[model samples]
Target: MSFTTRPTLQGTFGMVSSTHWLASQSAMGILERGGNAFDAAVTAGFVLHVVEPHLNGPGGEVPAIVATARDPRPTVLCGQGPAPAGATIAHFRSLGLDLVPGAGPLAAAVPGAVDAWLLLLREHGTLSLAEVLEPAIGYAAAGHPLVGAVGATVTAVRSLFEQHWPTSAQLWLRGGRPPVAGERFTNPAYAHTLRRLVEAGQAAGGDREAQIEAARRAWGTGFVAEAIDAFSRRPFRDSSGRAHAGLVTGDDLAAYSATWEEPATLDWRGHTIAKTGFWGQGPVLLQSLAILDALDDGAYDTASAAGIHAQAEALTLAFADREAWYGDSADVPATALLDPAYARERAALIGDRASRELRPGSPGGAQPRLPDHVRSRVTHRVDVPDPTTGEPTVRSDGVTRGDTCHVDVVDRWGNMISATPSGGWLQSSPTIPELGFPLGSRLQMCWLQEGLPASLVPGRRPRTTLSPTLVLRDGEPVLACGTPGGDQQDQWQLPFLLRHLVGGQHLQQAIDAPAWHSLGVPSSFYPRESEPGVLLVEDRLDAAVVTALRSYGHEVRLADAWSLGRLCAVSRDPATGVLAAGANPRGMQGYACGR
Candidate 1:
């Protein structure tokens, strides 16, 4: 019955899995050297920045769920950066832009990934700063094999980089060309940047925590801040096809800091799911679970047409609520929206035909102020042809569903973390030559229109799609899992949990099961577009099941067998103290390591 390419690796020591093999190996190496999960994750996170530059960077954001052995209750580490103080709706509108550009300095948010990983390492880790950073520094200073996808992503926009982002060209291009895939590409400048951060930590005459705090200060208020400010002054072409100066300043970086927050949780079928609060899209899983929990029997085959239809409908309803209520603002009635009663009410709207509208109902009369783009029946189709392929760069509309990165780790001591890090991709903005990294374009998720929860507001987070999930069985932490797909992160992950928890499958079996996600809702990126009644599924599913789904009013599109998701998971059995891990094989890069 196993369709997996690799067996579920079980061990008594530790387990680490991620979107990239180098990161996973680096983490396992840390574990072998007696470092805890937090330290191992720090090492892996840094390496991920170097190896998967197109997916994430040091100038990105990572929101993580951390669970400890002593305290089984999970905690959310909010590393997602907020909008700069100068990033206001009026400021963007004054530039004659309707939506924030998806790529460029204008869409930059406060970079928070470096500080967040450092904070986790300083607080919960057993290793020194240098130990946690050594691997990534080596890979950057020397060289690491560049993956094909990274090369392709860079190639896709190589012409743009040469024309608009020369700083990016200087860093990414070898002989004015994209680095060859699988070649040993080195970033000595990036290594020096990390070295400076390490030196800052070493100079501070205090404990490990104090030193790490000093490093964070260096990143925010020191040379790094100055470099970011100077580079953003140069106008760059963005998704709007217009060049504009960015708004990020040194004060914006100084004013921000990573935080620890409470996670939203709910018990279902002997397991408790923990996710980020309303500021992110995590609660959609909780809400969807609520609706699914109300089903007559919870024992349906997940691969069946009935199961697929039910999950898609529930996700559609939940994402509708996301568009209306979920954001960084306090206007969101998160408690009421996640209520089982409300979920039951919403679930009642599911019909034989797929929902083709953005139907957000009243939650305590919250009166959802959804954006016109999200609710418009009229499609504002704008085509931007890619110079490289002579085809539309984006889809039917002007948006591309961008993605991020993830890492999951569970230690022998019962500590675990599931983190989704993204935003400041290499392709996001021009690289700051002095700092060797670019600022994140997360501000693009914010809307220019007012009165909505995700409205563009200075000093507030932009309601990111970067979400990670942790599962606890009977009040004890067991699983840390996540994936990398813009709005599809949770949708792609839900089925894995369903197959594992509902169908009693192993971790790898769950991960390797053909994945699919609904792209029916409006995308969260700039130039947001919606594809109503669309369901993108993998061809691995039974042909009959696919046909039956089409019969139920879904606009089915069959993707390659392993094209939909890049999920990774790590689980620790509370009773046996044994850990198991799995990674997606669709992309040749993902890896799982244990024992």
Candidate 2:
């Protein structure tokens, strides 16, 4: 894609991206068309599906949080599609299946993204759905350039696409091969779907029901439940051997519908942050913030080294607790995890030194502490061959990557939309005929154990890594930030945010700064279970810092400085009314614009 960077003369807005330039251009188009930030955001979301299908689409679950100038209080929209009411852990057990990986009809949930966008538009948007969707429709129909990120992703996942669904292979792979950068990629089927949505939306006159029906037609229906059934079958395999078709079918598509609920809000250290509890890892963020707030503010400044350490320690502890106790709130005591007293108790237990080992249950509760001075263990790394070259590449950990796109916008009226639409990596292999987009492989994120909290259950939401955040100063919107990195999302975001908010780094500087991550013991992904206490730092970090951390008894691995999440954000100065926007330089082309 062509790369052109120019500042917007009107109101300033920034786009951080991991997709292509066309996707970013789509959002700018919405702004130019007199649409508000929310409208532009929704438009961008739809466009990304067509331009960057490997990352996300209409069939994916979206967990988003939005802030409007009129209502400074941010609201968390549950863009997650819920598991079918008929799905259950027992069903899988009956079929003698333990784990379900990748996208399939069975992994599908009640997709809420389209409906969520409609709701946001209805509540605070200035443009019609038809208006917001025009860019996506046009791009999908006319085609766009395949930029670096899109080309790289396609090259990486081409094999999976070819083996899973014929239609997908037909669309993504040309002559049974992935296209390189600069290739013109077109999705006439997807384009037609977008056109239908626009046409139906235009005719609906803001009637949500009519618009949703139009979306259903555009995106095929009744595949969610069918996908579940396929998962219940033994030796799960589709007719193509790369996908499971029985688990997803046309009937399941008909039953799927998005739900709207009141957003969940939490007050942390006097800051009110909103997150959707209906699905995803939102509750984890809320709970983690609560635990952080319960601790001494002195322990967690954004700039101080000690503060950064404390923040990492706290997040690790919270994530550990999430793995152990967090699940579908409807089936568990989710609120208990957020209890202030419990959080304080948990924070008090974290010692200054590393724990050396993992403690399975709540470390703050009655669970015994892990052994002291535990020896580190390393496991054999598996080498998976690159689809295109047959060259072996190291698969660091087997944790399935989560695919998503994040956008944060602020309009002339001060309205802001911060959202991340995601699906765990690997869309279902077999395309559902006319749907165009693959259903999410979200079920793969769930643990296969019999008694675990995240075990499959009907209507339960997976603990997602997507976190869309909005920062406020004196009860007004100031910054909106988010990223896409599966579980690593918040882990990286927390540090970046602290650096920007507390370290006083400018927006672009904070995003451009080097970072580090800890894949502690009892690792979530495979091939590295015993390899705990390993700290992966961006190469840009001072060599001294790496040595110092190693001195503290940690295994440090150096990675490319820009190996972390893709960030997109916009900050509005309440005092000056000047909006500053910055896109991550490491990702695809992103820009800032407004009037």
Q: Which clashing pairs does model 1 show?
A: none
> What's the true lDDT of residue 148 in model 2?
51
- Which residues of candidate 1, in runs, are more than 4 Å off? 298-300, 377-401
lDDT of 1 by residue, 1-595 (tens): 7667899999999999999999999999999999999999999999999988888898889999999888889999999888998888999989998889888889988888988998899779988888889999999999999987767777778888888888888988879888888989888888999999889988997578878888899999998988887887889888888788888888888988899999988888889999999999999889888888776553245888888898888888889899888998557887788787887888888877787888887887667777776767434333433211111133211133357889999999999999998877888888888777888788888988887889888989989998899999977889999998888888987888898888889988998787777767777876777678878788888999899999989989777777768889999888899899999887778899989
Residue-level lDDT for 479 in candidate 2: 77
lDDT of model 2 at residue 68?
70
Candidate 2 deviation (Cα RMSD): 5.5
315-423: candidate 2 lDDT, tens digit per residue: 7677666566656633445556677887787677666665545544453354422211112344433233421111112121212344566777777667776788765
Q: Estimate each model's TM-score.
A: 0.96, 0.83
**Whole-model Cα lDDT of every candidate shown, in order:** 0.84, 0.59
RMSD of each: 2.7, 5.5
Task: Evaluate residue 188 in candidate 1 and report its C-alpha lDDT on the 0 to 100 scale.
Answer: 86
Query: By TM-score, how accurate is candidate 2?
Result: 0.83
Given candidate 1, what's the lDDT at residue 242?
A: 77
Worst window of 10 by summed lDDT in candidate 1: 388-397
